[model samples]
Target: MELEKKKIVEHNDLIMSSAKMDTVPLKFFELAVSEIDTFNPPKDNTIYLSKRDMFKFLNAKDNDNDKYHRFKQAISKMQKQAFFEIREEKGKGFVFRNIVPIPYVEWKSYSDEVKIRFDVEIMPYLTELKTNFTQFALTDIQGLNSKHSIIIYKWLNMNYNQFEYYKKNGNRDGQQLYNLCNPIIEVDELRWLTNTQKEYVGRFTNFEIYVIKKPIKEINKYTRFNVSYDKIREGRKITKIQFHISLKGEKTIENSSSKPKKVVTLADAQQSPYSQLLIGAFLLQISDVQDEKLMLSLAAKIYPKYDEFVEKYSLDILKKHLEYVKAHSTNIKDLVTYLDNALENYQKRLVGQEKDNKESKPKNRKKGVIQKEKIPDYISNPGKNKLTQKGIEDSKAADELLAKINGDLK
Candidate 1:
């Protein structure tokens, strides 16, 4: 089925605005947002959305009576709800503004499309966003099953995007680094944004269990980053939240361009042995190298170069490149040789792509207009590896080398 453009960008303020919604309505709202042309939204403010598209986007069975009923109910809920409240500073105080996203909904009996109009007042927030915007792929949250999950994903993604932008721009000052790298939000404010204030009010543990934990788990499982949070307590009561977000399989490198330095401290050396085992398991699972003995034997050979792989590309990217190799090559006699060739080809492709992008850009374009490099989706997780390890044994030499490697990282 043909899909609408797979991405949407909204002002960060709007994304971080407070909203209370159920799963279906939130999904519907996202579908409408996806249809919006953020750069040049239609002057009419009314957008026609296909029911078939909604069903497909939600992965629901189309033409089912119960599903259709739920869809209609969601639309009704959206129309009656104040879905967004934009807060801005006034001269002496603050002013709170609200918008009913779908002011009107029109549908005909037995029709496959629904017509809805956006509030004209909401236009400024949705269009002409030059800075402080959150851009994400629609597919990223389509599979999410909770409204809280969707909200948390967008919030975390906005922070991730900000972190990347600051890192790219060389904003390394201590205060700027802290602000950009760590997004510490008030617990009550987060509750307002996620619409859990009433349900989990004054009960941090319950809130964490029902609202925070599940969404973080789902976001990490289905999206690009692994998310965890630390609570800040005031007088034995939680008052703020500090989220720790990181892309899986890639060491959080300080400098974007510099090669990842090896661990150089005793404390850093502790992770080396674990890293080797994880990499070995990842290789075995992805390559379908059946013989545990053979896999361990080859892993031993590849162990010394583990840092090289981590330094050059993320584990996810390497896995994708390897999968590409597996799909394209008909004969793979030697697993080690095949892996080596795959890694080489992958690097070559990246270099070529970067060259092509630069050449395609206008030579006389404005200075400092750097094209943002898109980070690839999280393709696989090392922890998810299900390789059989009946006969495999750790190599003492590999362990020693990895310990040295870890120490070098410091």
Candidate 2:
């Protein structure tokens, strides 16, 4: 089936922006602790490692049934509890958190991929903030048990500037490192939440610096893409500011000059026909420069209108990819039409050969009758000689009668 190409247009008023936070979530931060009692008693507590003699470890030889049985009890225990939750705040967007038992062995494993799969399945509904927390907190899990504090500290330092570095590289590996450690089952690390941090007024345990992004105008700084729109309220006029932003994810913001920010729209950027032609070029730059998966995520944020922004580039790229596949095919057999023609030709050839064989073979006949194939001629002509002799006698008698009558008359 063929799908029609969709057209995408950018409005003059709309602008694009992206942003990311540097601080790790409190839940994850609490998880990173040295309390050994939270996990199963390890024979050697000095080094962080999974229990070597684990009753069941997934291996290549295990069948699906065996594997399912091994984890069945633990998985069942988790279903009863609400492992994840999403709640709303009045001004702020939302909150998502996971509350589950975390097995110690699972957390100690080095595989980041396994950790993330567990996280997504168990804690399915995190708000945008919680989502960011899951992504950022993955690396901190190791900090809990590692002996080298400096190395862990250094890693966090490097992580702080990851957004900017990722921007330049246009890759997701760095961002994914943290997300890789999110898990479905709560590990012993999470139990530390109850033990290590004492409750104050039953809320607000430890204070850590969380880097948040607010409007430049709020701080009285000049932002490049800020604009005002007029709204009428009770016959009075009110103006609101809109900003177009791209999150660099850098620890630092570069533009220091404080001017009253002006908002620049795609229409303002491309007022002329020449600039409109360049809009596609501009989109290409943004798509190429940004992380592809994050772009899809951001697309989800501004859906419907963003759908147009996404449909234009995404569909065309998909079409071009499919076209490449079609163009590169080397033979007719690669197509459906060719396969049909080949099958018809094969059937015709078989029928023609059978007809030719029948025409070339000799036919046998006996006793003025065509003999059936595979029967001996003697068997088919049984008593045929006796019948011939009787026919001759009859003919002689008739001839004599006719001759005698003719003589008498003369």
Candidate 3:
């Protein structure tokens, strides 16, 4: 598929604020907004996208059932999540205004399309762009696998471009070699932005592992900037995060004109001969399947041991080991220890099975023939909790209350 140019403009305040969104919905929003006529947004403020175009943009499967389900799910999430707009007051400190980007999303089973209307309140920030607005190409973020990476890339790009503009206009000091903009954000604020505060609360290590490290790595790898951060602590506790941003190369103008040379997907990786082993390594490192950073780090760690693991175990066996660990382990605090334990358990089970097979063989059987019984498929995921309809509604209600409480506290 040929990559298309999609551009979005937002106020710097909104760009710099805390907004939590999922990968799919965020991508949909970008695609939808790109369709809007920026100069003259429809008077009704509604944006439309056909089912075909949405699927194309997402690089999703063409199967109707899967596409429709995913589309609705993304819309539901976007409707529920709130975006915080940061504002500076004259007398008071910074204030946060809660705004939902799209208040209404409508789709019908009979129709082959979707409709999303920008909330009237959020229109001004999105539409007019005389000043204090950041414009970025959507293609620059297409390669990103996480929402946080996309957000950070945009934030850094905005600031970096502005820094360059200022320097060229003589607004910046002539002696300045490189632009260094440090945005000091509270810990809670960062969590809110990444949508992991609730899941990672009281566990900064998990947050660091999932939110901070991985996204920075992805941004540095896929985008045009190099990002790093310094933790600002408060007497042994990390209270704030100061992100240090700079362009990747010596080129002042960020270029995103060319398409990605290769686009790798999980499905493509799984089909490769060596990728199965890599996937097994990933499963070992993943504390939460949703955390992409852990998966990436796992692959990096297991690269040296690939041959050793491949020689000892087949891909199917390694996958079984992963499934067993995922189903049995409740919490993974240390990934290294967990992987070691998992490997030990796999070896023990293999030895036990071999012994049982040897004992069961008939006395008249061939001298060196070893009959190995096939391992059965895991029939159930015992540890997996199924969410009921009521439970889902209750959870959403609770999230709304929590968001309100957070807003009030601010």
Candidate 4:
């Protein structure tokens, strides 16, 4: 049996239609809302509220209120006019079907709004590609009272170009089609490609593509297939390597456990004076020692023989070392000690008047407490009513006027 649609009822001339259906729950809506920009009226699909959210909003003593009943009443009314259908699949959560009666509008037409979310496992691909999201206003919509199904479908179609671009560039970009024809694709693991990317690529028949990473130095390793000439392109290899460096973090490497680790010893490191300078520079960059004295102390620990090296080098080389240290790392413990002593001596030079001014900092006042007028008159006038004659008269007049106004208005 078809679920009945309700008719729009007249309530203060407002066309109100809504539905009550089991949803994915408030947790899903909370997660989605924080990430998605909500739809305004006329350009929006049916508003989805999780069953949990509805319960909270209604504030029923024990979830026994007729709040959901009111929603069903509205949807039924709207359905009678063929505006839309509030539907729930047997196992799937609630879905408000777009039933807006517009000519040239086919329900089976393609959707443009492809929303895909990923778990943390897919963060590498999502971050690398740098996806762009564009939103459009459904200006084609007529009225907020009218069904916005057509507007929503239009919205879906409008946003689909991005996935289409991903489709055309599938082969070169490592996008492939799945066996199932549905616009969604799931893989055990996908790097440099989103689940959404999989959806676009997985719509093919026999074509399959895979991602291959190569070092920048090894660009000519693979062969390319030419479509027009049916031969490889002259001097151009298919397996070209592209190097990508990330400031956020390293790119994901599959089979990480199998890779060999490279370790260097302190003696091996000390063999290269340049390497020592690099290490010192790196340490200075990483350290949180703000005091120059602390930095000099750290430098002393890092290079106990720095002073001895200075005696062996020429004046020019010594200057170069200082320059390299300054350029590479700012380990400035010695500088901080000098600055601190200088600041203390400077402060000692201040006059008594200056010290008094420095000590006498202004106090921030509380809003009402510091105001003279706001302090209650009870403290000053113990005998008086504290309420002035004007106040009593005003109160009496307001009471009398309110009674007269209520009588007249009614």
lDDT of 4: 0.28
Residues 203-249 of candidate 2: C-alpha lDDT, one tens digit per residue: 22221111112212221132112211121121111122112222223
Query: How close to the true structure is residue 284 of candidate 4, measured as C-alpha lDDT?
Result: 27
TM-score of 1: 0.59
Model 3 / residue 78 / CA error / Å: 2.1
| Best by the lDDT measure | 1
In model 3, which residue pairs have backbone atoms overlapping below 3 Å? none
Candidate 3 per-residue lDDT over residues 74-116, each given as its tens digit: 8888888745455545565766677777878787778867788
TM accuracy, model 3? 0.54
RMSD of 2: 34.8
Arrange candidates, best TM-score first.
1, 3, 2, 4
Best by TM-score: 1
Q: How many pairs of residues collide in model 3?
A: 0
- CA deviation > 4 Å runs, candidate 3: 1-3, 63-65, 81-91, 107-112, 174-188, 232-235, 251-410
TM-score of each: 0.59, 0.18, 0.54, 0.15
Q: Ten residues in a row with the worst lDDT in model 4?
A: 222-231
- Kindly report which residue stretches of model 2 are placed more than 4 angstroms away from their true locations once superposed: 1-49, 52-84, 87-140, 145-162, 169-198, 201-410
